[model samples]
Target: MTRSTITGTAPPEAGATDPGRTTAAVPRTGRLTPWLVLALVVLAGSAVLALTIGPANITAAEVLGSTRYHVLTWLAEHGLGFLDPGENPLSRIRDAIVWEGRAPRLFTAAAVGAGLALSGAVMQAITRNPLADPYLLGVSSGAALGAVAVLLLGFTLALPLAAFIGALAALGATLALAGIGGRLTPSRTILAGIAVAQGASALVSFAIVASAQGDSYREIINWLLGSVAGASWSSVAIAVGALVLIGTVLLASARTLDAFTFGDTAAASLGVHVTRTRWLLLTITALLVGAMVAVSGSIGFIGLVVPHVVRLLLGARHARLLPVAALVGAVFLLWADTGARTFFAPSEVPVGILTAAIGAPVFAWLLLRTRGQS
Candidate 1:
């Protein structure tokens, strides 16, 4: 184990993962070809279904038509065969629904999932906590309290801002509580997050109970539980920006993050600024989570589960696990959201509920495995 120099902060710089071995000499971790091909096809297929499948009842063929037309139109070709502008009512509405309405939401789901999962992986490494997750750390709950209050008070204009404020404040509180003398420990950090979650939950209850508009509470609660139902380009822009910023920062510190897993004292011995890096990284992650929760609501389990799954597959290396976890998170949430919206047809369940249902069983199985190993 050697201390590596931290380079200029941006997307990660590719370096030789195995220092002693050249590329040709390095052994393949496993057969990634099949999985890589599968992931590509799934992503592409998911995009098609995400664009086409919704409450709108548009067919995949119409989605292909509109998408093909866009590509061919760019090439000055006329063979895409998109229906005429006013020839059919179904095609017109179908194009609008798929291209305009659903695509952005689905893209947001993928991006948000990746962002949350990436952040979670970093946090788990930084804190050395298997249970670390964005939503579980009170970031989502704090954002929900702020966003929910804004909704109930007819301050839709300020909802995102309010959510950001709550998220930052919550992070501040968590850090303050976690600090001892001047530094934080992983256990303290986890405890503070749990306390903040409880506090935010109480605040949410009060806000809902005191709302003047009783009718809006159900819809507001649904949003708190998380949904990408009304996601649009404007909000997706914010999510995408958060994803890029946080993903870059975390990946930049991947080696340092891996060091933290060996314990803070051990990491510090390796020339990593154990305390300062943890503070900066955790705050950055909280900011990212807060921003995500504002738009997508409190989509849970993604932050906790995706990283663990990736670690299990990749053998605890942050470099490989981080990117793969991001992809898995994206794919998992996109499909989870799809199931929530489509499983019951005319009625859509909150995706959060679906995530919880799927995550809980998997979580139990994981716990059982851990116990068995112990």
Candidate 2:
């Protein structure tokens, strides 16, 4: 079928910003700006609510008041003394809970969610696979192995750095395996990733068995299951930094990604450097996923589910889809992590478990719906 037929719309106008692009058709009754604004507002509200709903029993008013006071204090410290009104409404403990504990975790959630969703969307587009996820490249498994190794071996290197290295190593292995005979086909890439992920996971299990002792198993298992409870300002920095650095490049390459919807041959015909672009986008995605996994472990399904939901609402234009998916993913995960922490009260569940529980059902429904349509 032609690109237009597949997209269910004609190609964009020649003089349009995205000329010749095939954006998925959705109803044109509503403007994108309003939806985007709504998503942003929801995300902001979710972050605040997540901050308030932790085990401390803090009120929304208290959270807001504390946030305001800190903002004013920071401004005052930075030569904008006029911004300070000299009122401290929150106690030190409350401030610590908000600023040091919940706030960093929430920020990390937003960054990780955004990065994973964007990475998944790009992966699906480039590979033309509905089931593609950030972990499809074995990055998450690789990261888990790295963290387990560090824990077992008592390595002085930070867990995040080690996990990032492991993720890169897995990506290298995947690429090498997939590109063995000729061009990297999607089937070959997926199979290679599966192999790498299984190998890395086995290695992680071996490391745990050999070195993990008593409570070490608890720590290793928790990290593997993925929790944001341990998030700190450093984790926030790593997640946000990776999102900004790599996410920007991915967003800038939206046109290239959109072109890939029509396959590599069509993308090449449209002046896209198909091979180089694929490599560059995949590498950037791997880096983003690795950094996030380093901070939060391998939280699943944000990447797999968020983009598809966003596409349903906003259509398949990467220009619109990428940002919207990021925002929606941020909101979804902020709430999901909040549930993980608060749902079981004093005993916290891993955020990854919650996502999988939620995502697996949703994925099944999506699969059935797609099959019905076909």
Candidate 3:
């Protein structure tokens, strides 16, 4: 075949009359749309199931009733109601469990999952490394250190702010270390991040050992292990707000991320401001990771594994990959968190532990597959 036929770019003589031929070279949207729809459906169902699967044993009907009651109540309070305030079918306790307890936790899980997955995908792209994740820059470890300090010092109210500061500090330090020679290469960045992560982790351990006592130690350990157990509406607000804002920015920059796939020079040739874009994206990612860790602790592997799984199914085009990965991550973590809480009954496993248990094997398989391909 001629080059024109192989690449689907027609010769100059044929281009004027056969413009439709170029369409064949594009990735098929039909093949991807169904998967995206399926992911959304699964996420919706998972959210419902997660809301019902806690220790309370609330049925689907009660969950639905509670949600409807709260919506109507809010509407009535805001003078937009078409229903009576007294029409709630769920009892007060069940309503509270569904609305106050499970709902916030599930929402926080979904937001954190989506944010982490998106951040991972972007990091992998920007760094040109398949194994890169949100924590590759030490954001999680730094956030953990800040969170541990807050728990130790009894400044729980400032946990989120402290974590954010810690994450930014770690990022700054990583960048400074990586840019020692006035150039930021992926290898240098990764090495610097590892150093930062180790240092932050040590600080966390020392803080815990020095200050934690009894329940404080347990709480610190639980937070380090990652759980959404104490999630409140306020936690939901923080997570969802960060996910909506930073996640939207990341998703909108999908084309720019795609540019980075071809390396800095090529992306610059394509009119992408490589350094500025990279810095902006990295800072945004740090913010998302910090916010998530602040709310849900350092949940592991959702970021690392979700994007790889999605990429295996959807290919590596960022536009399609980002949204689908976000949905899949949300669904995956919702179930994982649910299993963490209910799998062993009364005693709870950390959600991070469950993710690591599942992710480690999946990661091993992926590594083997990648090696075989190589």
Q: What is each predicted model's overall lDDT from 0 to 1? A: 0.77, 0.85, 0.84
Give candidate 3's error at residue 38 in angstroms: 1.9
Candidate 1 on 251-370: residue-level lDDT in tens?
Answer: 778788878878988999999998899889998988888888877888888888888877766557676667677778888888888887789877888888999899888878878877
List pairs with backbone clashes in candidate 3: none
**Tens-digit lDDT track for model 3 on 1-374?**
00111222445675466776643333423355667778888888788777878666787777777677778889988999898765666678877878887888889988888988998999999999888999999988988888787889777557777877788788888888888876777778889999999999999988888889999899888888889988889889999999999988998898899898789999999999887888788878888898998888888888999999888876687887898888888888888888888888789888999999999999999889889765
- In order of appearance, the predictions have TM-scores of 0.83, 0.91, 0.89
TM accuracy, model 2? 0.91
lDDT of candidate 2 over 1-374, digit per residue (tens): 01111332434552367534533344523456667788889988888878888666888888888788888888888888776556666688878888987899999988988988999999999889988999998999999988987888888788899999989999999999999988887788889999999999999988988889888788888889888888999999999999988888887887788898888899999999887788778888998999999999999988999999888776787877888888888887888888988899889999999999999898888788778766
Query: Which residue pairs overlap in candidate 2's backbone?
Result: none
How many pairs of residues in model 2 come into backbone collision? Answer: 0
Clashes of 1: 0
Candidates, ranked, TM-score: 2, 3, 1
